[model samples]
Target: MGRMMLKNWLALLTAVFIGLSLAVISIVPPSPQGLDTPDDQFSSARAMVDVRMIAAAPHPTGSEENAKVRTYLAGQLTALGMDVDISASTLPEKALARLNRWSGQSKTEQPIYNVIGVLPGADRTKPALLLMAHHDTVWASPGSADDTVGIASILEIVRAVNETGQPARDLIVLFTDGEEVGLSGARHFFSENPLRNKVGAVINFEARGGGGTANLFQTSEGNGDAARLFARAVRQPSGNSAATYIYRILPNDTDLTPALKGDYAAYNIANIGKAEYYHSPKIDADALSESTVQHMGSQGLDLTRALLSADGFPRKKPDATFFDLFGLWTVIYAPVWGWAFLGVTLLCYILPLRRDMLRKDTLVGAVKMVGFMVIGGVVLFGLNALSGGGSGADYYDRLAAIPRLEAVAGLTIFAVFFGTFGRSQLSENGVLGATLPLFILAVAGQSIAPTATYFISLTVLLCAIATFIRRSKQTETYGQWISAAVAAILIGYMVSFGHLLMLGVGPDLPSVAILPAALAVLAILPLWRGLPKRVVTVASIASLGLAIAIALWIRLDPIASTVPLY
Candidate 1:
C-alpha cells in the first residue's frame, strides 16, 4: 500500500510538471532579434532606436515634444524613400474637451499634425496598404508600451519592406497624433483626407502593457478571408475568434476604430501583459520588452508582405473560427464545423458506456460537478472582493495587481477542485457524468456563438476521448499513462487560456475564470484516484490558505508608484 501511494504521487507530479512546462512555453513571446539580423527581416534592435527617441518624454498633442517626434518620424520616412508629409488639422470639440481636462487649462488651440508617407509600388494604380500607429502620449507617461512600441514596429516593418523591394501596391505609413486624446488625428484623416480613398487595407498596431505575445485581437466585419490570410502568413500567430468576439462587445476603441468606417480590410494587433506598466509614468524605452516589439513587427511584416503581393484585398466573407495551437500554428475553419465536433464529442462519450455502470453514481457525479462550478465561482468572487475588487476600487491599481490576482485565482481553484472531488472514487459512468454540464454549455455556445464555442467543444471532446481510452483498457498498465498525456494537453491549453483571460479582464472579473477551471477539471477527472481523506483535507486547507494570503497581500499593497498621476 505504501509503495502504491508513492507511485501514484510520482505519476501525479509528473503529469502536472509536463502540463505547466507546456503552458509556460505557449505563452512566452519570441526571443528578440539583434542588429545583426538581416535587413530584410524585422529586428527589435532596429526598432528600439526609434522607441527610445520617440518615447523620451510625454509628447501629448500640441506640445513642442510632439512636434519634435513628428519631425523625426517624417524625416525617417523620407530617408526610407517614401513621399512624406505632415497634415495639420484642428481637433474636434469633443477631443478638445478631453485635452483641456488632461492639461488643466481652458485656453484653446487644438492643433494635431498627422505624419503620412507613401512608398510608391510597381503598380501605383492599385489601392494602397496602410500601416498605422499613434505618435502621442498621455499627460505624464513616457508611453513606451502604449503607442511608442507600435510606432517603432511600423518603422522597422517599413525598413524591412524597402529592403525586399517595391511592393505590388503602394504602402502608406500613418503616425497619427492625439490617439491618447480621443483618437483625434485618426478621426480627422479618415473622414477628411483624400488619401483615405486610396487605402485598400489597414493594419493598426497598439498595446496595453509593456510585454507579452502580440495578438490579432480585432478585425473588420466578415473577416473570413482576412483571417485565413493571417493564418497562412504569420508563422508564430496568436489570436482567436473568441478574442475578437469579446472585443467587439467591450466598450474599447483603438485608432482602428475610425478607419473601420472606410471600405477596407482591417486588422488590429496588440499585446496585453505586464499590466502594471500600461500608461505608467515610469514606463520608459529602457523598461520596455524587446521580445514584444519583435513579435509585433515580425507578424506585421509577414502579413504586409503577403497583402502587398496578393492580387487584391480580401473580399468580405462570413467570419471564420481560428486560433493558434500553442503558438506553433493556427487552426482555422468555418463555424459550421462546430456542429460536427459536437456530434463527435457526443459519440465519444456514449460509445464507451457499459450496461453494468450504475445510473445512480452517474447522477451523483453530474450533481457534484454542477455544485463544484457554482461553489468555486462564489469562492472566487469572495476572494476577488477581499483583494479590493468591485465598486470603489481604483481601476489602475487593480490593473497593477493582475499578476498577483491571477495567482490567487489559480490557487483558489486548485483548492476548490481538491475539496470537491479528491476523495471520490468515480466509476466510468461517473466520469462521463462529470463532463455533462460543460458538454451542455458547449452545445448552447455552438448554437448561439459558434466562433467562441470551439474551445469548450474541443475540451469536451478531448476529455471524452481520455475517458474512452481508460474505460477500454481498464486492466492495462499503460492506459492510465495515455490518459495522463491527454490531460497534460488539455491542462496546458486551459492554463494558458486562463492566463490570457486574467490579463484581459481579471482586474474586474476574476470570477470569470470558473469556466476554464471547470474545463480543466474534466481532463483531470478521468485520471483521478481517490486519496486518503486526511491527505485531501490537508492539501485543500494549505492551498486555500496560500490563496488568501496572496489576496491579502494585494489588498494591503500600496498603489504602484508608476501609475499615471492624471
Candidate 2:
C-alpha cells in the first residue's frame, strides 16, 4: 500500500509539472528585441523611444500635452516619407459634457486633433491599409501601455515597412484622439473623413494592462476570410474564435468599435496581463513591458506586410472556429466541425461501455460532476464577494487586485476539486458518466453558438479519447502514460484559458472559472486514485483557508496607490 501510494503521488506530480510548464510557455510573451535588431524588423527598443515621449505624461484629448503628442507623431510620420495632416474637429456635445463633468469644468468647446499620415504605394488606386492607435490617455494615467505602446508599435511598423520598400497599396496611419473619453476621434474619422472610402483593411493596436501576450481579440463580422489571412500571415499568433464571439456580446468598446461601421476588414488586437495596471496613474513608460510591445509589433508587422502584398482584402464569409495551439500555430476549421467532434466523442464513450458500466455508478458520477460545478461556482462567487466584488466596488481597484484574486480563485478551485473528487477512485462507468454534462453542454453550444463552442467540444473529445485509451489498456503502463500525456495537454490549455478569463472578467465574475476547472478535472478523473481521507481533508482545508485569507486581505487592503484620484 505504501509503495502504491508513492507511485500514485509521483505520477500526479509529473503530470502537474508538465501541464504547468506548458501553460507558462503558452502564456508568456516573447523576449524583447534590442535597438541592434535589423532596421527591417520590429524592435521594442526602437518602439520604446516613441513610447517614452508619448507617455511622459497624461495627454487626454483637448489637453495641451495631447497637442505635443500629435505634432511629434506627425513629424515622425513625415520623416518616414508619409504625407501627414492633423484633422482637427470639435468634440461632440455629449462627449464634451462628459469631459467637463469629469474635469469639474463648464467649457462649451473642446477640439480633438487626429493625426493622419498617408504612405503612398506603387499603385495609389488600390484600397489603403490603415494602422490605428489612439494618442490620448485617461486622467492621471501616464498611459504607457494603454495607447503609447500601440502608437509606438505603429511607428515601428511603418519604419520597418519603409525599409522593405513601398507597399503594393497605400498605408494610412491614424492616431485618433479622445479614445479614453468616448472614441470621439475615431467616430469623427470613420463618419466624416473622405479617406474612410479608401480603407479596405484596418489593424488597430490597443492594450488593457502593462504586459502579456497580445491577442487578436476581435475581428469584423463574417471573419472567415480575415481569420484565415491572420493565421497564414502571423508567425506567432495568439487568438481564438471564442474571444471574438465573447467580445461581440460584451458591452466593451475600443476605437475599432466605430471603424466597424465602415465596409472594411478589421482586427482589434490587445494584451491583457498585469491587469491591475490598467488606467492606473502609476503606469508609465518605465513601467511598461518591452516584450509585450515586441509581441504586438512583430505580429502587426507580419500581418501588415501580408495585407500590403495581397491582391485584395479578405471578403465577408461565415466566421470560422479557430484557436492557437500553445501559441505555436493556429488551428482553424468551420463551425460545423464541432458537431463532428461531438459525434466522435459520443462514439468513443459509447464503444467501451459494458452492461455493468451503465449502472448506478454512472449516475452517481454525473451527479458528482454537477455538484462540483455548482458548489465550486458558488464558492468562487462567495469568495469574490468577500474580496469586494459586486455593486459599489471600485473598478480600477478591482483591476489592481486581479493577481491576488486569481490566486484566490485558483486555490479555491483546488480545494473544491479535492473536497469533491479526491477521496474516490472513480469506476470506468463513473468516469464516462462525469463527461455527460459537459458533452451535453458542448452539443447545446454547438447548436446555438458554434464559434465559441470549439473549446467545449474539443475538451470533451479529448477526455473521451483519454477514457477509451485507459479502458482499453487498463493494465498497461504505457496506457497510463498516454492518458497522462492527454491530461497534461488539456490541463495546460485550461490553465492558460483560465488565466485569460480571470484577466478579462475575474474582478466581477470569477465563478466563471468553474467551467474550465471542471473541464480540466474531467480530463484527470480517469487517472485519479483515491487519496486517504485525512490527506484529502487536510489539503482541502488548507487551500480553502489560504483562499479565504487572500480574499480578506483584498477586502481590507486600501485602494491601490496607483488608482486615479478621480
> Each candidate's lDDT (Cα)?
0.88, 0.91
**Cα deviation of 90, candidate 1, in Å:** 0.8
Give the per-residue lDDT digits (tens) of candidate 1, residues 1-566.
Answer: 57755665566667778888888877998899999999999999999999999999988888889989999999999999999989999887888888888888885778899999999999999999999999999888888888998899999999999998888899999999989889999998899899999999999999988898899999998999999999999997888999999999999999999998888999999987988888888889987999999999998999999999989898899999999878778899999998888888878767766786658888877887898889888889999999889999988889899989989998888888888888977777787778888899999999998887789988888777666666675634665676677778878888998899999999888888989888878877766778889999999999999999999999998887868878
Model 2 spans > 4 angstroms off: 2-8, 473-477
RMSD (Cα, Å) of candidate 2?
1.4
Cα lDDT tens digits, model 2, 82-112, are: 9999999999888898788767889999999
Top candidate when judged by TM-score against the true structure: 2
Local lDDT at 417 for model 2? 89
Cα deviation of 39, candidate 1, in Å? 1.1
Clashing pairs in 2: none
Query: Residue 63: error of model 1 in Å?
Result: 1.0
Angstrom error of the Cα, residue 422, model 2: value is 0.9
